[model samples]
Target: MKSEFYCWLANKLPRGLAYWCAIRVMSHAACANPAQEVDTLTPAQCLKAWPK
Candidate 1:
């Protein structure tokens, strides 16, 4: 496959961020989608959610 798009994109992005995005794009297939948003609790959110 040609990498003209990737080169153009990578040049526009800042440094190592391009590689980070590239790895995720290359590793995953079209059908296999990773969970982008997760529900988790932080100390502040926990306190706000269940305040005493």
Candidate 2:
């Protein structure tokens, strides 16, 4: 999902801004995906949802 989001952003944004935007957008998107259950997520969930 993170890969898909970056692929989507890379296609939409300029190179200079693509990475930053992708990171921010992916974070927001991950937190919003219903399957992920944002409300029940713990810090560990956060790490898993969008790990480095």
**RMSD (Å) per prediction:** 15.7, 9.0
What is the C-alpha lDDT profile of model 2 across 1-52, one tens digit per residue? 9999967867987777866755565576566566775455565555555645
User: What TM-score does model 2 achieve against the real structure?
Assistant: 0.33
Question: In candidate 1, what are the lDDT values of residues 1-52, reduced to their tens digit?
Answer: 3689867866899878877764444444221323322233333433343324
Off by over 4 Å in 2: 1-14, 34-52
| lDDT, model 2, position 21 | 59
Whole-model lDDT, model 2: 0.64
Residue 20 local lDDT, model 2 = 76
Off by over 4 Å in 1: 1-9, 30-52
The candidate maximizing lDDT is 2
